[model samples]
Target: MSSAALPTSALAISAAIRSGSLSATDVTRAALDLVSARDGEIGAFTTVTAERALNEAQAVDRLRAEGSKLGPLAGVPYGVKDLFDIKGLSTLAGSKINRTRPPADADAVLIQRMTAAGAILLGGLNMGEFAYDFTGENAHHGPSRNPLDTKRMSGGSSGGSAAAVAAGFLPLSLGSDTNGSIRVPSAFCGLYGLKPTYGRLPRTGTFPFCDSLDHLGPFARTVGDLALCYDVLQGWDGGDVACVDRPSEQASQELAKGATGLRTAVAGGYFRRGADPSAIAAVDRAAHALGASEEIDIPDVTRARAAAFLITNAEGSALHLDNLRHRAEDFDPDTRDRFLAGAMLPASWYIAAQRFRLQFEAAMRKVFSEFDILLAPSTPFSAPLLGQKTMMLGGSEVPLRPNIGIFTQPISFIGLPVAAVPVRVDGPMPYGVQVIARPWREDLCLRAAAVIEAAGVAHMTPSSL
Candidate 1:
């Protein structure tokens, strides 16, 4: 099937299946065929559960034939970053070592929720090894290539999730953001990605990166799909200590409300300091669409980023210390070295960083008291070329890997919600702006993003795969 003939959004596919214009089985097969034909070049899938997908698709068709009630995402096909557990597949987490581990007896909580909502899981997608890298250059499995330009890097650790959606292999995918995995890849690959407030969704059964900073969210070609996937994944899970007990906030219903009665601001100072021209322009365009003229400075943002890095290193190192002591060589060299360094950090530094985080969160909360949504560049530039190490930022050359998450780390550090909305331009690759909101206020972020998308300032254009 031609790319143009494929359904562009999850809602479109679900609606067609519901109306009997399409069969769930046929839709699933087309998605599988697309992966078979294009994933060799894109490198998006780490595993494809063909048998399970077919079985689930058939079940959806049966439910439809019986005229039974269906969930919101019925008949939609989706993928998740490899860190999420699928019953019989060993969660590789983009690593060579974990391939030999025992299979998870049950699916991750989010997987169960998605399946319960009638979304078929095709399989696990690739990610950065142990969710550490910003560039999606996984050494164990090859890097997930950008769908826009095959030679450019898809941002990690959610690279596969973004690439698969952008390549049109799937309409939606789940990804984890630790310091910007979801937003970075979404920005680079030209998709809508949401990082919900910390503890908003259950993290049970998913592999851990940094427990404090890690958040699982959805990536899709449109903002509505992002909100749809997020709404379904809501609810409390006692299995996750951080899981917030709350009622589901239907962001899709609130999307039409737009930015009315909301105060908006463009992030200045550190946010604008090192951004490339395209990054700055993208933020400007998004701000203008939302009528945001006030530029607010987020105090001590650089320090927040530093604290986030320290916490990530400390937590990630503690999680992998046993492996580093014995199976060190089994890890990706790039990831292995970083873990090794993290393992050697002083105890006092980690403690101090944790304390600083509370201070930083309080400062950001004060900023939110005045502004409902803050706009900033998601990345300093668009996707960098594959294997290209350095890039020009603010007239100086800097390493590409760590700096890609420069704008994102500060926000996630305080556990704020953000919607990364793609801003398509005539440039070689598209960039995005972060629609940020205060803690537990993803509704605000999605609403502002919906406004930007409705105005034609931000939207996902399918890549020529």
Candidate 2:
């Protein structure tokens, strides 16, 4: 089957499969063929589970023949970041040392949820080493290139997840966001990515980067697809202590509201600073579409970002201390150095950051009381050229890797749900704006994103590749 003949959206694909217009096995094979033919240019998949995928697709077809009821995501093809366990593959987490570990005994909780929803898993994706870096330059596995422009970065550590959907290989993909992994890649790749409220979705069976900050969510070309995947993945899981025991709140039905009666504001002060012209314009466009004329300052966001940094460093370092002690040579030098510094941090710093984090969350809760949505730039700039380091920020040159998450970290620090919507621009590359909402209010974020999307201000652009 030609790529052009396949349905581009998850819902459409699922409907076709259910209606017998497309067989699950044929659709799955076509998607695998596309990955095999073009993924080399983008390096999105670390392992393409063709045999497993075909087997699953055949199962779906068998069920259909038996006249069984199908789930919402029946026959929809997708992939996940390498950190998620996949039953028989080593969960690489984008590290060379992890290659020595035994294959996983079971799939991650989210993967199981997707399978139960009738979604077919295509493979495991490439990502930043141990989810530490933001540039998507994996030292062990080759970097996952931007699908729009292969020469540019795809953004990390969920770079491959973003690239796969943007490249038209999949309609949906799962990724983790400890610090802007989902949003950064979404911004760069021109896709809608949801960084659901922390603890909103279960993280069991996924390799840990920062237990305190890590969040798993989905990437899709459309807001509807993102909402569908998120709703299906929701519910409590005892395996992950961080997973809150909350009832599943579906957002797919909330899209029709479209920012109606919602008090929206544009984030000013810290968020507006250090951004390129295009990045700020993207926020302005989204805000205008959402009727967010009011601008509000989030106090001490700079400090909030610092606290997030400390928490991430300390937690990530502790989890990998054993690996750092022994197989240091197998580690990616950039990731290893960050983990080393994190290990040496005084315990008091982590404690102080945790204290300040509570204060930050409280402050944000108050701000949310006044507004239903806050719009901010997803990235300070579009995708940077691959392997090209350093960029100008705030009238001075700054290291590129750490600064990419400047706008996103503060929001993530407080565990708020955010929908990163790609904003249309005149340039070749694309950037995005974050539609942020209060904790457990992913519906509001998705609603605001739908508003922007309906206005044609935020939508995914096809990749040139």
* The candidate that achieves the highest TM-score relative to the unseen native structure: 2
Which pairs of residues collide in candidate 2?
none
**Native-to-model Cα distance after best TM-score fit, residue 33 in candidate 1, in Å:** 0.7
TM-scores for candidates 1 onward, in order: 0.98, 0.99
Error of 1 at 136 (Å): 1.0
Q: List the residue pairs that clash in candidate 1.
A: none
Candidate models: Cα lDDT each = 0.91, 0.92
Root mean square deviation (Cα) for candidate 1? 1.1
Instruction: Output the lDDT of residue 99, model 1.
Output: 84
Per residue, candidate 2 scores C-alpha lDDT tens digits across 369-408 of 9999999999999999999779999889989999999999
